[model samples]
Target: MKTLTKEMQAAITPDMALDLLKQGNARFVNNLKINRNLLQQANETSDGQHPFAVILSCIDSRTSAELIFDQGLGDIFSVRVAGNIINEDILGSMEFGCKVAGSKIIVVLGHTKCGAIKGACDHVEMGNLTALLTKIRPAVDEELTITENRNSSNPEFVEKVSEINVKRTVRSIVERSPILRDMIKAGEIQIVGGIHDITTGVVQFHEVESL
Candidate 1:
């Protein structure tokens, strides 16, 4: 596959953009790859980028959205942060990726065994990161199934909080950004959430909430 051009990106529907990521993840899980010259794609996208989807994921080294989605240069916009939490900066980036640049879909991609989620689960505090972890505390609170072992020591609690955080970020995006919310209502774009299994390399996508 070649790098996406302005027209190509424009032609892709929100569903098609999502399907592309799903197919790419399938390839990733099977250790498959598309034969594309990275250098050539670099030159192709030098003038401008027309990415079809914008993915907000964690800053985990193991969870690079480009690699996991098997997308080449200019295929997608990646906005990464700890916990994949929603904030003003992230919201602005998504707005630019879609309303300004014409991306078709937005994905809040979280992963298993996320350190930030763990910190939130444990209520870790140590400077600026304390504030960041606070953003994830709501998700940790929403994970009600784990009563006894609510801290990071329990893997199940951490993972549950991870999943909840992704879904929350997905909704928060729509709730926070009026530009994106209007775009969603006008059928111009869409938002969804998913969890990336680190060991398996398979991303289990969640439902796109109608909110």
Candidate 2:
């Protein structure tokens, strides 16, 4: 696989960028990863990078965007945070990645069996992590389907909150950032959400044309 160049990044459309990720994930699942020289790609992208997309995913070790997407260096920008929640700093980073960096799409990626989500589900509080989990409270509240057992031990409840959190993050990005919102409205960029299955390594994407 070749490293992404400025010209290649420019030529890629939002849908095309998404398709590239889908294809990459398929390769990951089938263990048919593209072979590329890391040193060569690093040397080629030393001067500058023109990544096609910016992915906001959880800090889970199993849900690495680059590996799961089968992307080479400079192919995509990966932003990681626990629970994949949206905040001012994260919005600014996404703005920089898309508005200033010429990325075509933004993805809010969540995953199954996420520790952060579990923490939020159980209201785990530990020093700074308490503040971080506070951001995920809305998602936990939004998941009203499972009122009986809304704690972390209940796997179904945790999974439901996880999905809601990704979707909420996807919407919160556009609602929070005017630069990204205008870009999305003008078709310059696209936003979507996905849930990564740790066991299967399959990312089930939820499409949101505008939100």
Candidate 3:
């Protein structure tokens, strides 16, 4: 497949962008990946990149956005952080990706069995990571179920909190960036969240409205 052009990016509606990702993931799951010459793709994208989507995902080894989405070089802008939490710098990157760089979608991707989510669930306080994990604390606090087993060791509670974290990150992006919000309001761009099942290689997008 060819790298997306500016017109192609601009032509994608919110629904279409979501559909593209869904289809890409389906291809990934079925191992029907598109054949591409990676070296040629690298050369094609050398002069510039026109990524179609901006993915805010975790630092997890198992959840690389491009690999899971079946995208090649210059296909997506990946903004990774522990817990996939949003902050000022991440918001700036998203702004640049959508408003300046012509990305059509922003996906806040969290995954099951994420170490960052586990850290947040367990309330692990390290030196700098303490502050980073603090961003996900609200999601942990918002989780009402599994009161007795609130730690990361509880798989059910951890998954629930992970989902909440993805939704919260989606909201935070819109709330923190007026540029992104206007883009969404004008239907120029879209933001959504999803959870990746590491063991199964499945990514389940949350309801669009919930984003």
Candidate 4:
């Protein structure tokens, strides 16, 4: 109910951070949200923001990190893009969030029925979005289980690609950012990936492994 502080953030271990998000999502699914005054939280965090986690998620309206995680203001850093792909700028933001800003964890969150993943699956092209969706193309191509229907129309294929995208993004973050890679290696921070079920309001973490 109170704004996160540096001490609190520092106290969180990688496993603890994962647990916190799990509990938050449990609260979300059950509609048993914590009672907090957002205006008060905003006022308390005005001086500084000590977000506990940095969430790389989609720009999809249904996958808002704050709402899905049931976090309040100054609770988490939300870095959003169409496909949750990592670019130079996004890697810089992650560096700042964990290396400089004292966040404990980084979560690459993808969701079921994600438009971005579907676009990538079907090779949807637009002006600038063409390049953006291209980032997710590897995931679509990596889904070998669903060989027959490898397009967005196949719900299973779409979901598989979405999961692959989350894991790929997680790997890309550590590969692209030396600072973040060092932090993960030194046990100062942790990176994980998850898939959000839009219909169920649940997030399932993919796997736990060191980068």
Ranking by lDDT: 1, 2, 4, 3
Q: Write the per-residue lDDT of candidate 3 for residues 11-66, one digit (tens) a residue.
A: 87778888888998999898999887889889878887888889999999999998
Error of 1 at 104 (Å): 0.3
> lDDT tens digits, residues 68-145, model 1?
999999998999999999899889999999998999999999999999999999889999999999999999989888
Model 4 TM-score on a 0 to 1 scale: 0.97
**TM-score of predicted structure 2:** 0.98
What's the number of clashes in each of the models?
0, 0, 0, 0
The 0-to-1 C-alpha lDDT of every candidate, in the order given, reads: 0.93, 0.92, 0.89, 0.90
Evaluated at residue 30, the lDDT of candidate 4 is 99
User: Which ten residues in a row are the worst by lDDT in model 1?
Assistant: 202-211
Higher-ranked by lDDT: 2 or 4: 2
TM-score of each: 0.98, 0.98, 0.96, 0.97
Q: Which segments of candidate 1 are over 4 A away from where they belong? A: none
**What residue runs in model 2 are displaced by over 4 Å at the alpha carbon?**
none
Model 4 scores worst on lDDT over the 10 consecutive residues at 202-211
* Colliding pairs, model 2: none
Cα-based lDDT at residue 99, candidate 1? 91
